[model samples]
Target: MKTILVIEDDIGIQKQLKWSLSEFELVFAQDRQSALTQLRRYEPDVVTLDLGLPPDEANATEGLACLNDILNFNPNCKVIVITGNTDNSHALKAIALGAYDYYQKPIDADVLNVTLNRAFKLAQLEAENRALRSSNVAAQEIIGNSDAMIKACRTVEKIAPTEITTLLLGESGTGKEVFARAIHKQSPRVKKPFVAINCASIPENLLESELFGYERGAFTGANKTTLGKIECANGGTLLLDEIGDMPLSLQAKMLRFLQERVIERIGGRQEIEVDVRVICATHRNLSEMVAEQSFREDLYYRISEITLVIPPLRDRGHDIIVIAKALLHRFNDEFNSKIQGFSDCAMQAMMQHSWPGNIRELQNKLKSAVILADSKQISAEDLGLTAQSSKTATLRMVREQAESQAIRHAHSLASGNLSKTADILGVTRPTLYALIEKYKLLDLRTTESETQQ
Candidate 1:
């Protein structure tokens, strides 16, 4: 049974409530202090707070204070304020102060029971949603249930245990580095160092030294022998972010290191052997660079032994909402704000906006919105997004997206079993096969033998 903390001071009314709310595990408190004690002890999800507690029963002073206390102790707790018919002002004030709902008394058991049940159901739902988000976010710090994201994650799981040279291709701010870290965490070299260096951020003159280190007096700044990123990440992973930005002069040396598994530092003849798994990421098209003779083709092929393409936020469909919600939960805790969720207009705006800057843009918008939001729910205006900025989706586009998402979701639920997926979608097997091929989801299709087994 769910617990409800009842803060009614009147003995006769309390007795009436005890009988009326017999289905719940009720804890009674006549004043603010006792109510807080019962609140801490039971940690009840729902509370019936009478806005007329002793001493100040005529007014709502004590009752309002008690309501604030309960909310402060646990923001998620649902407080249903109880007030006299004439106490309309107090009831409104309580609601404004974060009470879930307000109730007018000459207590109707049936009516209050209905309200309590609704509150309990909502609380349960929010709890479950939080758990689900936590699990997804905790796993490799990757959040999204979209088909594109699922495919990427599954590929990572399959390849993380191996020592393949992985290349992550994505648009800027699409979380390529985050995926690199996820691979490192899942790899057998997880306990070893995971070094990351942005090739684009470092100067061309110093990039070689940064990657392969130098001996004492190798250059003006080289006073002592130093281990480079590759050497430092020995037995672990080295992420070369924006690898497309690497200078052509250094590309040949990099390719040599990949092939030889040894590096000769600047001003040093000794070939120091190093064992490191290289993971490269870039927003630039290395293939075009190779075609343009700007990047070495051999090096590109070496780094891309196993490539994973991260989908842009716009292509991720409902994943935008999933990521936004996860970010909201995080920013709420960071800002200590009671922002419950996004408004309908805000959600529509998010869905419509083309996230050219991707996850980085989303994070910045949400962080700022959480801090500056005037209401409990964030509005489109709060995110600095307008309806005009959103692209108008065609009917065909919407239908296709919905169908793809539904098929992918069902396919996953059935563990790639086409017959089961078809059954779940209330479709024939042949129709399901056609739809899967239409969406280019052949990669997720199960073989006939595997399905039979």
Candidate 2:
């Protein structure tokens, strides 16, 4: 049964309400101090507050103060304020102060009961939504509290509900597929299939058939009709990994399907429509490839309607430790070990090491450490990482150097288009411009431009 804390000063009315609302587990308090005490004890989900209590029973001062206290204790709790029929100002004030609803005195149990039920239902719905989001985050393999990773998670939250083609650009092992799956999990078509194919992993000869399916008897061993990744993911999402490496010939076919949302299998006559949300991920610089005519310009535009640039692991500060600990816990559970935590040396080593392979490297190192560790606490040696470096550069300087190097890299990859470089660097045009000046990148930009022409 749901708990409701009723705060009423009048003894007779208090008894009346307790007897009337007997279906709920009831706790009653006659004044502000007692009400607050009961609030801490029961932690009720809803409260019925009378806005006229002792010392100021004739006014609403004491009652409003109690309402604020109740909300401060637990903001999610629903509070319904009871007032006199003409006490319009007090009722609205109670609501403004976070009361869920206002009820005039001379209560009708049936009507008030209906309102209370509605509040409980709403709270339940909100709780379920929070649970789903939590599961989705874990499913995406996302674990971090750092502001940079948090911003990336927030971007996932904002774009998860849409059907636009999203492009994820980052170095390898930065969890692009994880973010892609997160988007699919939060979409309306989550119940359908989520199919992913790596364009670079497959040979060019088989890549086309893998994406658009093959008709029966279309090739040497075409004994049966087969559905492609796109068709299999109908009403869901399709993740094209390493899209930059897709063959130039297939890029034209892929571009047509993207433009038309229809595909015709090799040696097939019918144009089959597949309703899949497309997400492309790549470490290779597609924009520069487009400029060099290795990738089609139209295809680049088609795949990157909205792009999410994932910051590398080194840029995420203590997120490295957070992710490592979580992975440690998971590995401990999987391997049936009792490792307590990381040694101080191990933690320091993690913070100092530059994770070139991002989360994948971190996960692999932890897995190997768990297998090798004999003691309860893991040490720096166990994780296959060395102790602190002797270099004298401050962390801030290291970050600036990394940022400068990345900007120069993107400049070369993007052929010095400020907009494309900004997109690749995951910054606004103004911020990229400031970085260019700060890093003395103007000469590099000029070199890139001269080489491009």
Candidate 3:
């Protein structure tokens, strides 16, 4: 049972309160000092305080002090102040001091009971909401700042309202499932279930049964009546991941269900109506599969009412940096590491390299780098990227390399004509003279008459 602490100086009032609040384990205190002691001892969920307490029953100073102390000890604790009917100003002051509520004497039992119950229910609801918010943050863990990702968010916003079937087309590891969940979260059916089934993961023989379920004694292992994924996702969404891998025969049945909004269990003669919004995803080119006569054309049309193309990570500008920071936070929590962040060289290397497997490849590399990194920050070598060697190894060596290459290339291409070389390179005559001065290519810079054919 919830505990309640009462701080009232009157012995008669304490007796009445204790008897009235019999539903809870009530603790009584006659003064501010005793009330604070009981508060810490019991850690009660609620408290009732009478402003008339010892040391000065005429003033509400002691009660107000106790209320502040109780709240400081446990911010979630609810405290109700009992004041005289005429002392409306003091009641308002008590409220501003963070009392949960106020009661004016003579207190009505029914009114106080309603107030207490409301406080308890509010606390319970707040706890539940906090838990739900934490779960939402956990589910939305994927992060990126690319233009493609921004467009994807917009597409989600547009299609989440209507009851249209969506097809997510992307390469493997390009986060098709993440986008699918995002769609479901934004849809009208967010409160309902979102069932995801991979067509390619299950064997061909069992795929139909998995999608459509089976009746009792339908097969050797079918001991009881079972509902299919479509039925399970009624009033919500069903994600058919890798739909391109579904068998040709089952594809026809899936199309029938999409059209008719009904399904039949395996070895059952009854047609059960189902309400489900279908969302499909596949990495393969469905058009080619249709041309090859492997996939049904009718099914493709049913699933692709709205198509979303997710660009691979390589094409998304500056997304590498955004993704790196998110992955760092994730790995830090996962491995219990105190690593600060990525090094400058590491960021440059990530920008330079091509992420062939897209986001999945980046995730794997960061995981390894986090585990193997000796210093607080991850460096380019930790990520196994080779530093560019052609740049400045030294200043004089760089100048010599630059001059020798420029002179030889210009001499070879121009064949001893300075004006022709400058014209061919699209450089101004004076700029060409600067190069000739710097590289000491004066021999190549013969007179203009010598340059003429």
Expressed as tens digits, the lDDT of each residue in 30-92 for candidate 3 is 998898899889988788888877797888888778877887788667788888758587776
- Ranking the candidates on TM-score from highest down gives 1, 2, 3
Candidate 1 global CA lDDT score = 0.87
lDDT of 2 by residue, 35-147 (tens): 99999999988899998999899999999999889888987788999987484989876765667778897888876887788778756644543454475553345776567
- lDDT preference between candidates 1 and 3, better one: 1
**Model 1 segments more than 4 A misplaced:** 1-140, 388-453
For candidate 2, give the lDDT of residue 83: 86
| Tens-digit lDDT track of model 1 for 89-112 | 788767757787888978899779
How far residue 265's Cα lies from its native spot in candidate 2, in Å, is: 1.1
Point to the candidate with the largest TM-score. 1
Give the clashing pairs for model 3.
none
Model 1, residue 393: C-alpha shift (Å):
12
Error of 1 at 365 (Å): 1.3
**Against the correct fold, how does model 2 do in TM-score?**
0.58
